[model samples]
Target: MTDIRIDIREKVFPAVGQAAAHAAIQDFHLTLHSGEFVCLVGPSGCGKTTLLNIVAGLDRDYRGEIRIGRQQALPKIGYIFQNPRLLPWRTVRQNIELVLQESSAGNTVDFLLEAMRLTRFQHVYPERLSLGMSRRVAIIRAFAIDPELLLMDEPFVSLDPPTARQVRELLLDLWRKRPHTVLFVTHDLREAIALADRLIFLSPSPMSVIGDIRVPIERHLRQDENEIEAFRRRLLDGAPHIKQLL
Candidate 1:
């Protein structure tokens, strides 16, 4: 188990010829304990994804220090993007196996498939699966690698309401089993309320942490509609500006 420390002093996107540059994050300091599920929310185009990219080490042109526990080596990171980025040609089981090839975790593909209720669809290709099912496979693939840190970028976005709720439940189940240190990005305040141990709110642009609200209710209580609504109100009251975006 490894804790994370992120101290991003500044991050800038340089101008491409005539296009003006933009500041994505500035003086953004955050920390995540092992097994903590943290959610990031803000107005659209506020560089939430940019912040995830930096933490995942995909974009390194920035002035900052990101340390993971005490390990000098880079942590193994798993990412679930907005779209289910599974290979179109590969079957669901094969997609998960691809990630497992490098991992020491044995027989994880089948276990995760069953856990996510994708066992019957293991042999199906990405195109054959529904949007929700594909996303489940995508999640299974991420966890198959047993990553030290998981970064999810609106994994349930754009789905129909019912389907989105189903996926959220499935995600919660899988998360409870492993409890990997997770940083999830989302635009939905309710979804953040349902999943996060702590909700981190960012400013509109030139992203910076404006509020960090801990979810008052326990994880189990989130399933209760009344509790969910109550917590939602608490969040809005604490960060009134968030209501404007919603």
Candidate 2:
């Protein structure tokens, strides 16, 4: 893990033909320390995903500076999107192997599968697994890449509450074993509180950092109902705007 700096003075998508340039991010500056978990929370369509894309180098038509590690060589990045985006035809193990190269020698896949409790389903196809299982496979795949930074975009958006909680627990466990710089984007305030070491609130569209709050409780203590409720009440009392996003 290494220090990463994101300094985006402005990011605009050029107009195609007669359309006007769409501004997605403006004057957004953030620095993430090694192995820190930071969550980006904001309203719908607030360009949270766009910011993640820019950081991931998926979108280049933007004005910004994103520096990774200490050198010009970009660190490995693992991205998990809203959907699992798995190959329906591939088995869970095969899907995990897809991102692995021959030169990359490690027991990462085995370790991740064991840690995530996915060893039993290694031979299962993506379509045969439940939504939760599919999402878990996607997560394992990301970790298999042995990334220095992990970017997740609403990874548990559509699951039942119980399933989502399970996934979150699994994520925390994996991260505890091997921490990486994580930038997670979601609109769920409670989820943000549960997972992030720091919470970054963004404005609507043409998003910019509006607030940055550090979670005081330890990661293991986050699952306590008393702590969660207390944090929720605190947010409602001090940060009403964030409560309204709920």
Candidate 3:
């Protein structure tokens, strides 16, 4: 059994002053085993990102108990946002190396550069790199830390379809090589279905877990368009609210 279990009891927050109190996450409970890849999908403002923030310990203002294994969930979180938040002054390798430096895990720099296919542009600054390369660098920076949990907030949202697909493939390959408990938040149902071992659907604002669907298809089949499409259709059938989002 994996050494991670997240239990979110009740998380409520005020919505910009207080016209009405909005429960960002109400009775949200999720159990994620280690080495599991879970994707969260929902309509906009459904508290998907809010839930991730709670798990990451970015926002402890809410009420809940988040635990990893027998210990309280520590702050060893790696976040990959929609934008490739890289420093313009630093080169690709330098940016990745900086993350390693924080942990004193210098050995991972080379491996991450190779894994992310950023070796060719190692010395290039963020401005010199293309959007895809910058995104890859951000991913490497996140993984370089060897985090216990990785939280991705629609990491590929800014890319074109082809670039996004490539990044997704790269992400899966890296995840396979170094398994970690991952909570990925995305609006794309197909992307979520392709990459996740389990699919979690959130309702509209003041989000709650409305559906939990296990994707039985093999992760290796993610590259197969037909299989991915079929699985996506099945997932949509299970979560009709998701279909409404489209």
lDDT of each model, Cα atoms only? 0.87, 0.87, 0.81
Order candidates by lDDT, high to low.
2, 1, 3
lDDT of 3 at 28: 75
Cα lDDT of model 2 by residue, 1-246, tens digit: 678988888888889999998888999999899989999999998889999998898987777778866564457999999989999898898899899985562487789888889889989888889999999999988888778999999999999999999999999999889888999998888898899999998987688988889998887798886897798688778987766665
Model 1 CA deviation exceeding 4 Å by range? 71-73, 102-106
Per-residue lDDT of candidate 3, residues 140-212 (tens digit): 8898888888999999987899999998889888988888789899988889888998988878866677788
lDDT of 2 at 36: 93
Candidate 3 runs further than 4 Å off: 15-18, 102-106, 238-242
Q: Put down candidate 1 lDDT per residue, 1-246, tens digits, no spaces.
A: 778998889999999999899888888999988998999989999989999998889998999888977754457899999989888988888888887765654468778888899989989888888999989988998988888899999999889989988989999999889779999999988889889999998987788888888887887788787888987887788666777766
lDDT of 3 at 164: 94
- Residue-level error in angstroms, candidate 3, position 207: 1.1
Task: Estimate the lDDT of model 3.
Answer: 0.81
Q: Sorted on TM-score, highest at the top, how do the candidates line up?
A: 1, 2, 3
- Give the TM-score (vs. native) of candidate 1: 0.95
